[model samples]
Target: MENIFNFNDESSINNVEIHGEYSLIIVILSIIIAVVASYTALSLNKRASENSFFHKNFWLFLASLCLGFGIWSMHFVGMSAFSLPVSMSYNNIMTVLSIIPAMLASFIAFYLANLPRRNLWTYFFAGIAMGTGISSMHYLGMYGMEMDVVYTYNPILFLASICIAIVVSVIAVYIFSTVQKYETNYKVQLIISLIIGLAISSMHYTGMAAMNFYIPKGYEMNLSHFHSTEMYGLAIIVTLGMTILLGILLLSSFIDRFIEYRANYYDPFTQLPNRRLFEKKLHSPKVLAVWHIHDLEHINREFNYAFGDEVIRRLVYIFKTLTPSKVEIYRIEGHRIALIARDGDSAKQLKGSLKEIATVLRKPIIVKGHEVYLYGVCAVSDANQYENTPNIYTNVLAVLNYPSITYNHDIVYYDSSIHTYTFEREIADDVNRAMNDDELFLVYQPKVCLNPNETVGLEALLRWNHPKYGFLSPAVFVPILEEYDRMVKVTDWIIGRVCQQIADWKLENISFKQVAINIPGEYVTSPLLLKLLTQKLNEYGLESSQIELEITENSFVKNMEEAMRAVGEFRKEGFSVALDDFGTGVSSLSYLKQMPISTLKIDKSFIDDVPISPKDSAIVQAIVTLGESLNLNVVIEGVETKEQVNFLKGASRKPIFQGYYFAKPMQPHELIQWYRETRVED
Candidate 1:
């Protein structure tokens, strides 16, 4: 065996240069330990910051042990790779004590990394602290080496190793902090771990290069009880132990992260993806349909919330089982489920799937021995039609929430027309403010007796002069108010203003018959309508006969029995009831015989083509003959031409007339002036 250095020739010891060779296997093992330890520590530190106090402290402690012991093992393993001429061993106590600095350094680094906010100086200081601790650990471990020779260091190389440790630690810490938010990005973590591992190896090898070991002149080397093999065995055991510990910690961290991801992106009840995941997927090009359980609230109100939840689960189950495989369903809202079509699926396919789901939902879902039926509508939007994810989502929501869909039950697709719905939604939000700001008012259109051509009554029409939109038609804002259920308030306001206007007319000694105020079909059945009407009539000291209640034929479509009962109550209260928009609805003939009414007003659609279209003229004649036979006063609406009036005159009875032919709807003051001027003309 050849010794790299020999102290037997004491006289030549000063001139002999000591050099050592390294075991490639041990060097490689040491590098592996460094990388594994760095990754484990960084992963644990990330978990520490995201957890509760107890778990955070627990993770932090584990991270410190992993990093500190990991660094110590690498140092000893590297030292074991070097073959010295004389036998060498480490002081067990000193070697064990050197790990304290590494652990403390790890704690400092982890603490700084988890800070809520940090600047450049924070990392610089953290690096300096960690680098100093690492440097101290290396030097202390070197000092623990037991041998007969004295060792010195090259000052420049020693300082350079410390600087290298600091610089690399700073870079590694910055990288970990930057990527910690992206927990799923393991590749970046691995790359950072490699950097840290190489940096540790570089510092260790650099420090080793700075070492100058020599035998003192005339001094004998001690080889008694010094086993180089035992040192190598110890290094191997420590490295293996730390590696196993770090591996377990890494596995635990991954398991915890997976559980957290599931909790975040999944709906526990339905076992489907949640809104959070759905929103994330919206960034891609796809067709999306949102199905809302419109009647789920009714179930919740009828039964208990638990029953509602069970119904929702059953509905979702139906959706999953019936929809195509390409459709991905998500529980985006409590009562809404969003369906997304994959790359190969088109909007048409998605719509077909929605229809299938709706068809299935029509069947009863038996829960708790009670049969529950669900009614929902689906709104579809294609990402390709929109500029971005937000626009697609907004447009889809607008289409879904459009007022007509509530009653129509048809699957609606997002298109340019939905912008009108979106605008109406905005107006719906401002309706209360509009009422408060005096933007809402009313105008009157007078109804005249045909033969005498005398103004008998007026139809009070509600109008909104929105500051932004400027004079929104009742056809526009009225439906929005009805959809949002804000019409109750507006209806109240209308009754109050109409009553006040009638009182003002009486004070002016203007002889007027009755003012007809149109009421929404939904409100016709509400007790509030009767209550508010009675309250306003009494408040303004007006008679019920002075205010005629005009309701469209569709009002009876929902609950004809209830509507008929409500109308009978109004008629008994001395209020005139008029069936408006005649011949437009399907159940008109049946309802006309049952409903208690004083007047029949033909819808403008049939009147618009009358006298020009013989069919329309025949229809109008039949309605007038029917109204006279039923002993109901008939008013022909939209009579814009003299020919139409002449055709109406041929009817057996003279019907009242209301249209632009007489006069357009006018403001209150304009109505007064028109009334005075009309009387003068007559």
Candidate 2:
């Protein structure tokens, strides 16, 4: 009571010493705030890369607020530790005003650190500015003290404290900036935060250590304005508020990351697992299968792609209803979806599920108020046998490449025996080479008039002679050409060559009525075919009637409108158009009347068993009658025996015949020689 608290008291104090009491709660809270703020700033800065200006600035603003609030709280809490012999209070105005520089300085610091590209110069300037702001906030808070006392500082310690703040702030900023790129783990971040907190604490204490308090005379008061309870409450409230805010920020950041990951790994349209996630699950043992929509391309070509999309969406919905919840479905790409069964399910069970789905899919769906049916093949691969993702996908895709394995069935398991993919790849290469190297040629099979027993016209056929395989049959290479999309080129070449042959024959005075060329379904709708045909006819100075465009019944069935237009154009230009392989396609009678067909060739299946099988004879007789009524010249195909020719000749109006009974398909020179020989015999 007798002034023993004074530092100058000789009996009570051995040396001139000042005492400070810090609230352990406040110190711990400040450290926690520092760590949380550092984490928030790091998270924000990491996301700032390649972000838009507004996006980067938004995160930078939040980071600044976080760190700024931490700095302000730490400084104020540490200030509450300073103890004196007299009652003291703070100026409420200056106490609130001190937060401005703290936040502004923090904003500058974080902005520079988060710069898309930062140099040493920006870092240095940011550090200095932040340090100045921190120092300003500290001094301003100190000025808030309303006690009747005078304070002075040691210049050296003051300067040292400022330098410590500047140097340490620069180091902290640099660490936060580079930690993300270097993949410095969270432990490193925690350690860096602690070091930063210590630096900040050191600067505050050092500044405090530099100060000396002198009580002014005649400044005594009966009741002091400051209360420890209010200060403690303020510290608690500030710490709790900041802790809650930081917790929310961290939680939101984690949630955003999770959402981003989901977006990357799942398909946007179907909300199913995407190719990225599917590839990741390849190592896990599960039955895998791929559903390929084989007719999606045709559907899209015939109708708009939106109809195709509707089909895919409906199929996915159907598959979802059929599959169990545990099964994983993925849309790998357009018209392809991959299904993976759980470990408990077997490959056989998976195939059954696919079959069920296919059954449901084959049913007609009402799209845009029109009924549309989807056709596809389900190819299953055993994941137990294939461990790698690419191998599994490739093996499954290989089965779909076989021309023999069509989409007519519900499902087809992976058949390793059909080495068609590799074989077809080789054939594709040869066909390309054949086109350029002129390794392919044409042969003409004579079509004879059955009643007169005289040859009328010849049907042109394509033949490929591979250097390795040697004289590959059309049955072998033609399908390969169609598979590889090389048929168009071959068709173009055949048209030009046949037209030239016709011209040459005319020059040789060898008269032939017509040379027929077969066109594939894919090229039936192509404008290029019509253009090429017109160009060849004009180039060769040949009449359109001399060369006939023969398309299969299947082409007309698949695309009736386009095929009709093509045929109409041919007929309009005085060219003859015929529908070949008549009985084999769907609804032969339905299409016969719709097409502009000048000639109808009876399919060989009916002609092969003619005069023996009653059904064959009846079918052929009906087709000939239908052709006659429609004014279409009927040509019977595959007349291999004189019995078949006699059967056709026995009809009231004999149909023309083409097959081995007349003559096998002959080369150009042989055809001319045979023509001369038969003329001489006549």
Best by TM-score: 2
> How do the predictions measure up, each by TM-score?
0.42, 0.51
- Can you write out model 1's per-residue Cα lDDT over 425-498, one digit (the tens) per residue? 78788888887888888899999874554788999888888775445546556766888888878878888888
User: Which regions of candidate 2 fall more than 4 Å away from where they truly are?
Assistant: 1-21, 28-32, 39-62, 79-100, 111-120, 136-163, 171-191, 206-249, 252-256, 295-312, 344-349, 366-371, 383-390, 419-682
Full-model lDDT for every candidate: 0.77, 0.72
Off by over 4 Å in 1: 1-5, 8-21, 24-70, 84-101, 109-288, 298-308, 342-352, 368-371, 379-399, 402-682
Clashes of 1: 0
RMSD of each: 27.6, 29.3
- The CA lDDT at 242 in model 1 is 78
